[model samples]
Each structure stands twice: as structure tokens, then as C-alpha cells.
Target: MTTSFQKKTRSKVLQIPGAKPSIYNNQLLISTGIPSLDHILGGGVAVGTILLIEEDTYGNYARLMLKYFCAEAVMTGHSLLLASADADPEQILKELPAPIIDDPGKGEATLEEPSHDSSSDNMKIAWRYRHLPKFQSNTSGVKFGHYYDLSKTMESELTQTVDISTVDSSLCACDSKQTDGEFNNPGYNSLLKTIQEKIMANGFSTTTQVEKRNILRLALHSIGSPMWGEKGGLTENEMYSPALPRFLVGLKAILRTAYACCVITVPAHLFCDKAYVRRLERLTDTVVEVDSFVGSDKEKNPVYKDYHGLFNIKQLPCLNSLVCNMPDSLDLAFKLRRKKLTIEKLHLPPDLSETANRSQEDPLKNLKPSSGCGTGGRSNKLEF
Candidate 1:
């Protein structure tokens, strides 16, 4: 006799929008908030995977993706942002996209109010059809998400734990234990250690109470820069510095045990040797490079004119067996708009609008062709 799994199965949900996999899978996937990107990453990145976005040019594009990831996480109530970049953590958090609001003004659709009258409950289904019941799901699952504002300052509770660079000795094992259960604005290794502590504390709560699981969205911008004092000119602080590998190793271990995901953008070329960068890649699950590999020349193509940068997904996320919920493949395109940054599948652009065709008054189209050497004037074909 086979038992049915109807009642025991819970909805596979990420804590917020553009995060988490599905409503009924054993594996957990978080949506990246960018619809196209989330679709590509098999239903958002797996929790605990470190996404490394390497810089191709000035590194501005990489920074934008990092910001988008953080903004989405924030919008969905995953507010535990751990920024390890040289930039101001507060500024980064403050620059996330504004929360999407459902406006009921100007005759727009508003949420329906629930009816509390007892008379409505009395109208029940006939007993003849009781064996086949319909599933009525609640649409309020997204309500638990928090709204974030880019223009305003974050509240005290919406936290940011920034761990910029510092000498490894400054935060040795002795001082780390004394960090008072908080790794706020500490050194490199300290941040990883703190994250590990949080992961261990949560244990496996993610697997059981999946919906209520709060994920950590860590944005470590520019791991090696002069501001942090890691760069020492002409040697990448003499082979991967003293703190980077240790930090990455500890962070990877924590991710394996935690209910969190990380997006760390780094210019490994400037800071680490080839082998060092490989080690970082080995530790990470996804690696993306943002550059003009597809030709950023605006004069040649219209797509280049619209798109700001080219993206290459060097690595795909590691997911468990669940084919229906995952994407077919991961081919992506990126566009940076005045207000938004989008990453979508590389596709042919839609044809120009009819209005645009009417707007363009072509001077050459209506002009008659002048008589030329091989044209209507005369056939100048002489046998030689």
C-alpha cells in the first residue's frame, strides 16, 4: 500500500520575491529578484553558494548586479546585509531599488477585504462531491516581505554588518572570541567566523520551516583595494594576502551549513595570482564576468546601443535533482537603464515600432536614381 504525500508536503518558497525555488520541492532555491536571472539560475541561487562577479572594465557593472541582489533581498525581508567592500556600507544599502507598492488610488485594483460573516460559511459543497476537494491557496504569502526605500535612511533594525579589510593579527583568535556575538564592522576573518556562528545556530531550521527561513544576503564588494590596505603594489600583497584564502575557506564552510547566500564581487586579477583566483573560483559556485566581449561599439550594432555591458555566466549553480522547477539553460543578456539593471536571456530585439517608421523621414527613399555607368542611361558593353 503506497501512502499519499498530499498533506505532508509544504510549499517550496523562498523568504521573499525573486528568491526561493518552488512550493513543493525538497531542494531550496532563492530567486535573484531579476526575473530573467532568477529563471536562469534554476529558480534563484541555492542557499550558501557564493556568487563571484568578476570585473571586466571599471567594475561598475559588477557593482550594479551586487546592488540589485541586495535590493531584492531587502525588499523581501532578507535584511541581514554583510558588506565587506571599501565603500560605505550604509550608502550601498541606501542605494537599493525602492519597494514595489500596490497602489489602490486612481481606480487601480485594490486588495479585496475578507468577509467575516457566518452566513458565507454555511454555503458548503454538496456531500456527493466532498471526496474531490479543491485546494484554495492564500495569495498573501508575499505580505511577510519588507519594503525598502532607496532615498531614505534605513532604520536601526534593518541592519548592515560591514567587514572591510584589516590586518589578520588585529583580529586574532583571542580577540575574535571576545567579539560579543556580533561581528559588526570587523576584519575579514572575523566576518566569516561570525557568519559561521549564525549558520550553526540555525542548524537545519531551513529544511523544516522553509517559509519562515530568513536568508543572509552578503554583498562583499571589491575584496582587494588600496583603501583597505590589502594592495601592496606589484605582488597582490605577496600572494593572496594573509586573510583572503582563510576568509573564503571559512565562508564556504559556513555556507554549506547555513541558510544564506552570498554575492561577492572582486577584481581577482589585480589582487591575486592566477592560482589564487582559481582557489576563489573553486570555493565559489557561480562565476560571472561583466565586460564588452560582445563588442561595446555603439556604431556597429543597435543591441550594443541599448545594452550597457555583456555578461558571461562562467559557472552555473549546483542544484539537487528536480527537473521541472529548473530552467532549461542559462544564456543571459544585460541592460542598464536609468532606473533599473536587467539581466535576461540573450534574444533578438523586437522590430522597430510603426510610429518610429513614420517619424523617420528618409531623404534618400523618395529620390530617383541618377543615370550611372551601368544603369538606365546606356549599356556600355563593348567586346574586347
Candidate 2:
């Protein structure tokens, strides 16, 4: 335990009276849309920071909480960019807040490009706000920029887009033939190849490139799960080794293009060892853990079953949420907070009373022991 003397020393160090122009940088922070969480983060997320959200027993709740940020960004006119290597965007958006403006039905928004006769200033403004075609098919050598437009992305769906700057299009490792098989078995290689090609062809920037109109909240979901790979046969070592490097490189490129970056990762339990989680944590600037809680009949909850008590967002060390087991999340949170982290009760929609009541009848009926981690399920872990 830290003694009173050590606490005073630490506080003194943090509260040093400033001398003229110290070169120390600012602490990065992201808001959880909750007063308590924002307070814990020291303010809102620092500019150009990537926040990782992860959960296992309450994984769905974890994703739901992230939507709060996305909804806020959209309402504030930030262009939300969601990219998942595995899960479908539709599912992810369901847990998020609804969009402010619904553009018809098909998720498409079309705007006329200014003619060449238009002034250069007009083009500059247009480029800043427009949702450019960011996906491509590298193996087929087909460049499909501007071919598709997202007319509507529900706040709940998980978005999948290849930003084209981090991917190597020429070295296509994906095969497009098989559809009903595993992604790591060569079926989804074409998509990965396309993503890499787009990243390379689009020209990745190492320096921070700023844009005022397009504050793209980029969410690169689940990057290392072999389930998302298409070539198969990759050893655990091979997968874990490149996790951080690729993330770092991708993050650098993302910072250059978007105003904000949101990276969602699988729980740390999915990894074969602690080292994998460590590697993933190195790339993040802000980490938010999706903490699950038991339901209390005396209180109301969100409409969604998983939303029962998801408001408990915990901070992680190294700024990455690796929720494999309880220990990992707690460990990460403790490190990130640099001390004991306290959480408040998560508030949910009042309309969920019926659902909450039914769920409480048989809480663990649907839950099974988590095979990857010793923490078991949220039903058995959290006390309401």
C-alpha cells in the first residue's frame, strides 16, 4: 500500500508550481459522456488520441457505450468512420444513439462536386467535408472509389471501411472465391488486400494532417483476431508480433487524415498470453474498459439486455482496454488510472424496466463460463 508520505510526494510532483515554458506535453483525455468518467479522464480525450474499448462477458455492452461518443460526434458534425475487420457494422450501430439527420433509407448521401470552373477555395472546402470513396478491391485490380456511398449507417451497426492509406494493394493475399467459410481461410483475403492497397495507393502520412470539417471518428475494430484473417495457418506468435506495429503505423496514418480516432479491440482474454495484450496497449493514447455489472430489480435499466450496467467504464494501463478476464481489465484500469479507480452506477433508459425484470428472473440461464479467461461470466462476477 502507498503510504501517506508517498501520496503527498506524488501529488506534489503532479502539482508543481510552473516555471516558465516547461516542454512537458499535455495529458490526453476522452469523455465518457458521463461526468464521473470525464472527471476520471482528467477532461475529455486529448486531441489526436485513440480510445480502445473492450469487454468479454459484457462485450455487447462495451460496444454500446462507445456509441455514446459516436452519437455525440455525429450530432456535433464530426464525420464518423467505423471500420471493423470482422463484425458487421449494422450490429455495432444498434447500440449507439440514432443519427441526427436520416438521409432517406439506403445510407447514401450524394452531393454535387463543384465543376472545374469553380474556385480552388470551393474545392478545398468540398474535400474537407465530403465522404470520399475509401474502399477498394486490390486483387481484382478494381479501384472502386466513389462507387459506393453510405446513405445511412445506423448508430448500432459496426462499420467496415478500408482507409486505403495503410493497406498494400499490390500484394493481394486474399482470395475472393469462397463466401461461406472462415475469413482466415483465404475467403476474406481479397478484402484485406483491397484494404492494404487502398492504404498504400492513397498515400499514408506520417505527420499529423488536420481537417476542420471532417473530424472522422475512426474505429478500427478487432484487428488481430485470427477469425478475421483469410489465409489461415498463422501462428499465435506471428499474429501477436505485428499487432502493435501495424496499429501504430495505421494510427499514424489515421491521425494524418482524421480529426479523432476510435479503436475498438477484442478482450485481452482472446489473446494466448499477457504479452499480446501488452503489445496492443502500446499504441493507444486513451483506453476505456467496458465493465459489466449485475442487474438490480430495484432500479431501471437500458432497453438492451447487455446494457444492464455497462455505465461502469474502467480505465486501463497503457491506454488500451483489454477485457479478457476480470483481472486484465482491472489490471489495465488500475495502471491507466495510476491508482485505485472508483466507478459510479451506470444509468440506462427507463423504458427497459420490462426487459430488466424478465432478465433478472434467470440471470445466468444464458451465460456460460468464459473458456478463454478464468473470470467466468458477468452473471457470476458482478454484484448488483
Candidate 3:
């Protein structure tokens, strides 16, 4: 007689708040805070990758994206590490947009009207396509992301709930010898070290087992700019420094085995060398660039009047697979609505106005047929 053996059950995956499994690769993802952006970036940014944002010309829109990132963290109860040389992290945290809480009563009241409108709208489309599922920019069912009110700052009481850390590059102690040895910039080295320290201290490292697991969102603002103690990469003749690239490598290494992710905004437009920018992009997991039309001729053009800027996705990471999640559409634009920033498929306004339409007279009809060209007309004989 042999002793009976009991089968062991598999441990359940830790369910972190504000995070969801990606549809593409089943990796856990956290929102970038902007729902449309989260949609563009598959379900959301993966927990252990670096997201590089190429800043818009004035750095305005890029900064706003960073704020959205941090605001999402605050709303979801994730820890934040905000680093910046140009602005105080405290001030940036104070400016985070407040989360929009939906009222159940209001939703129920309007549900009938929206349903009617939707049915009518579907009826307007072709019968073959009417039954097709509607495309949603954000993930459906699970509340993985939340809408934010750009006009309102997050309440003080709300911000105090999450653990927050800051790294002010300006105040960081710099050792010239240390800077020379690795990363090439004291500010970069300091920031990297701070991030690594925070990961270990907060039990975010993969090896650190804790009772509760949460994501660490690191937001670095305006890196590679002059304020970070490096030549801002604006001049054509300036040699490319390996500092930023090295820092990214170190950062990637730190994140690979940790329960954290990072969002970095670089003044990419300021970088004169295209190859240098490419090198930086190669180092990051995901790359997006904001091309704002603020000071350009596009601002005056009617075709782009509806959008403030173009949103370009240069790269996406392949997590746990050979193929990465690709967005349905590549042409996208961003605009600031009354209360929030929105990213949508780039579309031109209909040509209803006479200014955009062609003249009433057909140009082809107005052209007289050449008398000697057609068989109906006689051509003059050439002299031999």
C-alpha cells in the first residue's frame, strides 16, 4: 500500500490595482493616464519597460503627457519617482490633473438617449457593416484606465495617499571623477543611482518578496537638455555624448528585473544629429514623438486646424514575444479639448465650404481640343 499524494494548486497572480493584462502578450500593463494614449500603446505601457517621449518643439505638450502619466499614478495608488532639473517635482505633482469620477445616476439617465442615437447611427451605415463591433480606443469592460479633468488639479488629500519620491538633478552631489568614469554626466549618473536605490528600498526589485506588490512609475522631464549639464544637442558641430545612451542602458537593466516602468521626455528636436537621436531610440523600449504645430505654417492651414499636433509612434516593445502589439492606425493627432487632451485618428474636416471645393466650371471641359490632333481635324503636311 502506497501513501496517497495530494496535488498542489498553482499560486494566483498578484492582482495590482490600476493594472491589467494586455490582450496581445498577457503582460501586465499600467496606463499612461491618457486613455487614447493608452489605446495607442496597446492596452497600456508594460510594467518593466522604458517609454521615451520626443518632446514637442516648445516642450509644452510633452510636459503635459508627463503630467498625465503622474496623475494616473496618483489616481491608481502607484508610487512615483519624478526627476527634473528644470522644475521642482513637488510643483509638478501639484499640477497633476484630477481624475474624473463618473456618476452612476447620470449614466443611467442618458443611457436610453445614447442607445437610440447609436442604433440610428448604425442604421445610417451599410447593412453589411452595421452588425460589426464598434472600435473602442480604450480597453473595454475592465476599468484599467480613467479619464482626467485637465482643468482641475488633484486634491491635496488624494495626492497624500500614494508614496512619492523626487530627484532634483541640480541638488545632486557631483563627483567629477565619478562622472568621467561612467555615464559621462554627473546629473545622469545621479539620477540613475537614485532610481536604482529607490527600486531596492521600495521592494520593487524582482528578488524582493513583499506582502503587497505595486508598480513604480518613474517620470523624467526634459532630459538631454542644457539644464542637465550637457550641451543640449542643438549645435551641428557638437560631438554626440554617450551619457544619455549609457544612462538608458543602465536604466533598462535596472527595470528588467524590477516591478517598475519609466516615462522619459527628451528634447529630441534640439538634437542636431539624426543618428544620435536614432541611437537614443535604439536604447529605449518604446518611442513616441510629439510634433506640435504651434509655430509652424501647419497652424494656419485649415486641413490641420482641428489638431494642435501630430502624434507619431516610432517604436513599440516586443514583450515576451517576437511580435509587438501594433495599433490599428498610424496617422494620429492630438488636440486639447475643453477639459482634457485627446488623441484620435487624424482626419480632415469635410470639404463643405466653397473655399475648399473646386470651381463650379469643370477645368477639363473648359479646355479646347487641339484642332490638328484628333482624326476629325486635318493636319498640315510637313515639308520634305
Question: Which candidate leads in TM-score?
Answer: 3
Better of 1 and 2 by lDDT: 1
| TM-scores of the models, in the order given | 0.58, 0.43, 0.82
- For each candidate, the alpha-carbon lDDT, in order, equals 0.55, 0.40, 0.82
318-350 in candidate 2: lDDT tens per residue?
A: 323343112212221211111112233332346
Ranking by TM-score: 3, 1, 2
TM-score of 1: 0.58
CA deviation > 4 Å runs, candidate 3: 1-12, 103-142, 172-183, 234-237, 352-384
Question: Lowest-scoring 10 consecutive residues by lDDT in candidate 1?
Answer: 103-112
Deviation of model 3 at 232, angstroms? 3.2
- Ranking of candidates on lDDT, top first: 3, 1, 2
- Candidate 3: tens digits of C-alpha lDDT, residues 193-216: 889999999999999999999999
Most accurate candidate by lDDT = 3
In candidate 2 the C-alpha lDDT for residue 99 amounts to 38
